[model samples]
Target chain A: MTHILDIKDLVTNFYTYEGVVKALNKVSFHVNHGSTFGLVGESGCGKSVTVRSIMQIVQSPGVIEGGEIHFSPDSDNGETGIDLLKQTERFMQDLRGNKISMIFQEPNAALNPIMTIGEQIAESYVFHRKNQIIEKILGLDRTGENLFPKVSANPLFLPLYHLALHRPDAFLLELIKKVPFLRNWDRAVLHTAIEKSVELLATLGIPNPDKIVHQYPHNLSGGMKQRVVIAIALASEPVLLIADEATSNLDVTVQAQILDLLKDLKKKNIISSILLITHDLGVVNETCDRVGVMYAGNLCEVGKVTDLFENPKHPYTKALLDSVPKIRQIGDLKSIAGNVPNLVNPPLGCRFHPRCGHAMAKCKEVFPEMTIVDDDHEVACYLYH
Target chain B: MVVVLFGVSVLMFSILMSFSPERRAVAYATSAKQIKEIPILVAKYGLDDPYHIQYIRWITQIFKGNFGYSTVASSPTLDAIIKYLPTTIELNLFSMPIIITLGIWLGTIAGIHRDTFIDHTTRIAAIVGWSLPTFLFALILLMIFYSQFQLFPPEVISDHIDDFISDNPDKFIQYTGMYVIDGLLNRNFEVVADALKHLVLPVVTQVTVVIAILVRVMRSSMLEEISKDYVITAKAKGVDINTIHQKHVKKNALLPAITISGWLVCLSIEGSVTVEFIFNRAGLGLLLVKAATQLDIPVVLAISLLLGLIYVVANLIIDVLYAVIDPRIRLN
Candidate 1:
């Protein structure tokens, strides 16, 4: 299968008062097209940083020291591919919410307060597919011939003479004078755009889209707002959707519902792939086809979900699996030893050496590179290396 | 919600006052004639009605913009209220923007730079602003700027545009209630400049304390907002630092700042008394102070009602603004 997104030797660092923190160290992973890839790790293990780096969304004090994020568009000819890391912000803006989109964790806070749900969703649609919406609204779709004749022979009352008679400079000056800052003209345009936006919201799952479109973000319930955000991300039919702990903030029931919605949408829309960043191993087991285990800031293991769960190779993966409580059994679950090491001054050799039960003297002295143990399984530990 | 409670309390007080035989005694000095007229005065003011009925009548009159005649001034209380309201509004409008802008900007900078010299200076400034009595500050400012430097005149400046227009009979346009508006209307550029210059010291004196408080509130709120998970999330998203500040930090910080601003505006009317006295400005503060000093019950009651109404309305606006700024707040 062709890789939709590839990150090679990613190293992200944060400059802080304490010291230089290596947030992500030599992280490398590939997410194939139409596949659900799960990145599971403890808090502060750089799972979120990796996903954010893919979308070119890292902020100041934190820097991507070295990395390459290559996203390939899944066209028939495979002609569209771009290195997102090297692209300008303008280019990234064009790509974001169109070719790639993100579903944030706290849906309540993520949506803009002043903006209505419908308007926010419609903004993505208008921005990415302006011509389509305008054409549809104006009944100007030209799928047939005689397009030129239709344009020339149109019988609608033309304001050509009126427009011509009003000199552009004079007209503009008059408009400015009457509006006192040209506020009214902008409002007229905005009002039309907002009207069309309500129509777009109707296409989403919002009930009474017209009424909901006028209501501010505060008026909607948490679930309704999350649906609105989902609608926004899916407006442009992006090929890759990054759900960064998307269900973490929600209750267990809501989490299950949202997860099911995402899964359902993913299957129906076969063109898109999901990159699910989560700390919940259970969520990964249920929703992911492939899983990548991260330790500290390194990708410790990568394998098919079934294989990894059935016969985990990496020590970190084994410990994580062992820690999960099984419904069939009734005993206390095993817990992973030690907390994640501070990235600012990480231990020498293996960053996970202090926590790994299988650590050897060699593990403490030499850092291991990822070694492919099988056709679909890779582990970055001495056992596999 | 608070308005409804206040209204009820005022109604209850009015009813309690009506039943008491001392209504005339309270209204005027006790004498043989006054004692005979006590029941008549009570009946005239509808003080004889039941508490609920009297409350309804009072509320209806207030709704119809009939605040009732002043017992002391023998003039319409509403008119007296309307006359003083514009002056208070002018003072507030001049000072509010300065306070909000200066506070947010200085506070944000201080918060962002925590222990730096700018931060330290801002902290000291906020401490002084919060701790110092408004009356003392007003007096000090008056002595320094007006008495010592002679930079400001010790009176409210009123270039009556109506009188000016009547005298000149050419410039009639009045877009704003400000002198600047009148100056511009008559095409008097020099007059506009002079007006602005004259306004400088008074506006500064009125706004200084408010600006200091706002800065402190904004800084603390910004600091708290900066530490939220979403800010970290935005950072991880590789969003520009400036975008994070503008979109994430600023909006979240606005919550507390806005809440404080509402209360501050309400309190400012009361707070302005000392400042008004110091500047010798004929604003509501001065009128209220004078009314209270002279035992002018009618003026005092009118002023209290007006202040209460303004406070209620301002709080409502603040609540609406909260919904505007933060989507998490549900209006319903």
Candidate 2:
């Protein structure tokens, strides 16, 4: 099986005035191609930090101390995988929106409020798909030359279009662009990009694409704005879509709709894999194929969603599953005993030993390595070992 | 806006009314004979009436463009403003652009490279510029550039250039009532260069002091804006760092800076009072100080009203710009 994204010993730290926060500690995981991999954890368990590291967008004061994020731009061909951490920033720019795109948690804060929805969505195409768009324009011009011989031969658009595609900043091109008759090529390119943006929005199930395209983010509802953000992410035809708590901020109905939309997009092969980060276990059960349980910057368990939920091995995962309130339960839900340790000075050995119910003296002295109890199921605990 | 203007006019009138009717009458007197007939003039202008009636009469005259006589300029107050306004406006036109652009540019550099040597240097510069008294700074610059080097002289155009323009009006039309502009219009490079030479010391003083306020405001604003979630979103979209800086961070950061800009412009006008006085330029600020010292009530009142109007108008422009820069402001 080919993994679209693989991680090995990923470590990230935040340098603050107080101390260096060990946000992520030697974490490792692999997201299978065409599968929805859910990272479930409590707040501040480094769930967001994990994917932010993968995308190389961790905020300032935080640094990726050590990590190997092996990403295959071509999903079916594993041999072409590159260590994303070693890639140049310029190379990362191309891979970011083109091969891997992200939908953020807060739609209200995600989109640039000043820019119109259409321009924002069309930006991906203009930046990443420039060659393809230029080629398409040239192909159309060729057809026009054959059919409308007199018009095509007389107009300066063909040359100007070539200049705009090839040497956009050429002095003669800029000077010619000021002339009224020769400006059509540039306008046509932008117009066609906007038309593609409208189609992309329509594909995301946004109504009144023609109207919404011209409106700012402030003019759209929370749901509509999230859809626009999704439209932008999907515009470049990314193979891996990382939804960072994408539906957590929306209303329940909107959340359901968004989840359904992601599922439908997956079914249609618009996205080959999804790294869905959420605190809600229900969302993972409904949407994810595989689940990874995180505790104090550590991945405590990894297995299929059903198997992890039914047979949680690590104490942290078991406690997390037990805490979910059931309809018929009369007593209080089981709560984890200790708070998440401050990662700056996290507990030694196993991070969960301080909070575990059956922690032996060995649990405090030595950390257990990952032990496989079932096929495709792994847990990091002495009990499991 | 209208209500605010009206309130400003009323407030100015009431302040003018605080002077006894006899003292207020002196504003209408032009010569020794008029001074003798001050009582009659006072009654004619309703100076002895209730304050509201007095305010009405004053506004009625202001509405007709009769701002009374200015003892400082020895001319009609309106005529004095017309003559002096252009020089102040010319000084601002040169300084405003440099102050705004440099302030924002330096602030962005400092904010982006926060805690680095560049940030520390700008911070110290801002502190020094902001803390030093403007008049003292202006005097120091005048001493270094004018008294010592004799490179830049005080006052509006030099005596020779002024003589050339007045001596040859046909060649140099005083368009816009500004020497630099009129020189440019007439293609007189000598006069334009001379006017700019005279402007250097004052412009430098104003730019330094004003940039301090803006740099601090913009630096904090930029820091706040770059930390916002939208900036992260932009980065996640694969935008180059410079593109994110220019297109995303700068535009959003300008909100607080825009709010400060209009006030800075207005404050610079007040700042020019000292700049003009120390530089010996015959602009409105110089006229204002001379008028106040000599109890030239009409000129003082006129200038006070003009300053109030300027502040109001600057605030209106700032509000409009706020709406233009941030769509959220428009929605609200």
Best by DockQ: 2
- Give me the candidate number with maximum lDDT: 2
Q: Please compute DockQ, using alpha carbons, for every candidate against the native two-chain complex.
A: 0.17, 0.72
Q: Please provide, for model 2 over A138-236, each residue's C-alpha lDDT reduced to its tens digit, 9 standing for 90 to 100.
A: 675443332111112224466766766778678987687567866445555556667788878878888899999988898999999899888888888
Model 1 C-alpha lDDT versus the unseen true structure: 0.72
Residue pairs of candidate 1 with colliding backbone atoms? A57-B237, A57-B238, A57-B239, A58-B237, A58-B238, A218-B327, B103-B215
Per-residue CA lDDT of candidate 1, range B1-332, in tens? 66564784485447344435344334553467776777677667665667678667766777788766654444676766666655566667777777777778888888778778999999898888777777677777778876899776555454563356457645545444455556777687755665565556566766677677788888889888776655543433334456567656787788888888888887776777777776776667877787666544456656777677777888899999987776667556
> What stretches of model 2 exceed 4 Å from their correct place?
A78-80, A140-188, B22-48
The TM-score that candidate 2 achieves is 0.93
Can you tell me which runs of candidate 1 are displaced by over 4 Å? Answer: A16-21, A59-61, A74-81, A131-225, A248-264, A268-270, A282-287, A327-332, B1-90, B97-151, B158-198, B215-255, B287-306, B316-332
Q: Model 2 Cα displacement at A192 (Å)? A: 2.4
Q: Each model's C-alpha lDDT?
A: 0.72, 0.86
Candidate with top TM-score is 2
Q: State the lDDT of candidate 1 residue by residue for A216-328, as single tens digits.
A: 76788787777766766776678898888888888888788888888888878833799999989899999999999998899999989999999898898899998888988
